[model samples]
Target: MKRIKNYFTIIAALIFFSGLADAQRSPQRAPQSKAIASSEDQCLFNGTYRIDVTESDRLYSVVEDARSSVPVRDQQQFFRDLSTRLTPPDMLAIECQGTRVTVGSSRAGKITYLADGINRRERLPDGSFVSSKITLGVDSLTFVSSGKAEDNVNVAFESLEDGRRLRVTRRIDAQQLPEPIVIQTLYDKISAAAEWNIYDGDRVAGKMGSAQPGAPPESNRAADALRSEFAIWIEATNRRDIAQQMRFYMDELQAFYLTRNTPKRAVRLEKERIFGSARSVDIRAGEPEIVFQNGGRTAI
Candidate 1:
């Protein structure tokens, strides 16, 4: 009877300790998750980005408005600004594993989420913030009052079919990264001396106009073909092959080269052949003419 009582007592103590340990661990896990997850207020980034509609092209304007608020003059500038957004500082999220944020059609308009990071913010009619940036794992994808925090709020979908429109909100604080470890390891390759491993060879290969053999250059195959053709053209020109040169140039360029008049040469006189005063030689632009003292005394 005493043994049974002792066993029950022991089991109760184990349960009590496990519960206490769980309570201690739960708080730690919450902060770690919160660190990656931003609040609605924290995620709320608001600023006026300009978009230029030159000739009121709906297709172009729609595409421009769907991606970003940054002002763009033409399609070229549009690509440039979008490239910037895809990079650092301006972007809200990096590659979040198991966390995806997308803008597309759904039953309740377009919805964006942090998936499992931070609670999202509510969007107002004027695109004002109702709360903080959505934390990850907060599966709240509703715009009930236009007052609660939302991930995708005030977003104007350019077209439901193409989804080309752009609406850039404030960039999230992804710039805040944890301190890098100084210790050398296989995983910390980019931060350590390993960055130089491929970079040094790449630099050399670029200067020499070839790849390092082990790794292919990032440029397309078309560029390599063009470079090879240029080399062959240079070689043919150095050899002075009329047939090869004719093959290298097009019809108009070949005619232009052949018809251009060659300049005539002047009389040759040695430095010692002339005597008396020196005279300046005036020559026109694009003409090659040399003048120097012919005699030991001076050339006239």
Candidate 2:
């Protein structure tokens, strides 16, 4: 009987030790999952992007308004120049690692900030100091910088279009100005393997191929045909030819008009009404930028 009791005790001890070992190993797996979550969260904003010049130019009115507030004097000319040439960097490279975020560009060099909501100070070339802070949110990242003269700048990067685009809003506040200068710009994420074709009114102006193997010849031909079709559509819209414009869209098409979706027939009727009422239509369309996706089956 004593031998039997000893065997049971040994088995109970083994089970307890095995559970303790599992408990220690479970915490190790938790940290790895956490790290994976962090990486996935950062992936949304981590990539190279190019500024959408056409979209950015649409917001130039805000810059013009701000420029009017400054005088022609040298001290104030700086403000004017800033407003006039407030062009965003042509290219932006973003990197996110743990609590650190880095934004780099040819114009702005490189800047690193901690997303811990703590203000960091750095001296400018003129020996003046500025305080800057960065905050990371669920879907946006905000950065604010202020100087001793009560002049401050705030920049926010928002992820839009399911992380395919970024909208950057900048606000400049100065003590001498009555209102802050606000400029908003859009950026399109550049895929590493993207193939771009530039169109100039139904003519292929240029083609940019990725470093990887080029798409099949058939695929390229199909893409070129689509590009040409798009250019012709734009030409039709510019000339206010409702019939030609309607040819590009399918009968069952649903077009997004401002805030709501309208069927193709309604779209045609609306276009007819507008074209009929207007004395003259002089629509100038910018160069179309096309990004091919789904193995050249879709373009956006």
Candidate 3:
């Protein structure tokens, strides 16, 4: 009886130790909490977006609306300052991580926000300062700015079309203004492969492709005019005429040169420095090829 009892005790100890080793080797995983899942859901706007010019309000109209309220004496100065503040960026890059969101704009630089409902003072590009707060919602992200004299601006961004498009709405209000200025803009999310379609009347006409279609008579004439203009510009460049080169661009022009989006003044300064430093310059430009787009109302 004693021998049998000893044999049973050894077997029981072996079984208990084996179970302990197995538990250490394969531990159970804790279920994910709801907070982590909600945090991930807030990243719907995480992508690069390009402004859709056709669907966005023109800057001229917005300026005109604001100009109506200002006095004639102050209109000129107010417009100068307002134009810089109201112009929308051409591209925006958005990043969402946890409760932090960062927005990078082509024109306005970059800004980071913590969506904790705390107001922070930030300086604008025009050197003016405003207190702003950013908040994240279920389906939209909002930014509100407050300035002096009851001046307030609200900007909201909402995802659309299954996150392929974004709608941005901006509202400006001030004590001097009788009515609020509201603007809505649309942006398209960029993807690895994208296609821009140009419509002609009721048909899809110019899809971006490698093959160049035969030019119409009107297109040929426009191409000739562009070539002539290009030749003149090239001549001016070789002669190092900064003023002549500058005449080719408009005041509101934004040129992408050397991988940077440079304004007209900066472009002029750069050209001036290059023209002044170089002793002899030889420039050769080929004939310009014009592609009629937007039903021939625009050309590229």
Best by lDDT: 3
Ranking by TM-score: 3, 2, 1
Collision pairs in model 2: none
Full-model lDDT, candidate 3:
0.56
What's the lDDT of the predicted structure labeled candidate 2? Answer: 0.54
Cα lDDT tens digits, model 1, 134-196, are 233222221111222212122111111121122322221111112210110011001111111
Winner of 2 and 3 under TM-score: 3
Q: Every model's Cα RMSD, please?
A: 29.2, 23.2, 22.7
TM-score of model 3 (CA atoms): 0.51
Runs in model 2 lying further than 4 Å from the true structure: 1-37, 57-60, 67-80, 123-128, 192-300
Report residue 259 deviation for candidate 2 (angstroms).
34
* Candidate 2 C-alpha lDDT tens digits along 1-300: 332233223222221111112112211222222222154355466766667766775433554445333344433334434443455655566666655565664243445555555566655445666666566654577777666433366778887887788888877665545677677878887752112121122212124344215656775566667768878887887788888999876655532322134578887887898788888866664544444445565554
The superposed Cα distance between candidate 1 and the true structure at residue 103, in angstroms, equals 18
How accurate locally, in lDDT, is each candidate?
Answer: 0.25, 0.54, 0.56
For candidate 3, write residues 161-280 as lDDT tens digits: 877888888776655457776778898886422221111111112322322355356655665677678898999989888888898886655433222345788878878876788889
Worst 10 residues of 2 by lDDT: 14-23
**Distance from true location, Cα of 135 in model 2, Å:** 1.3
Q: Work out candidate 2's RMSD over C-alphas.
A: 23.2
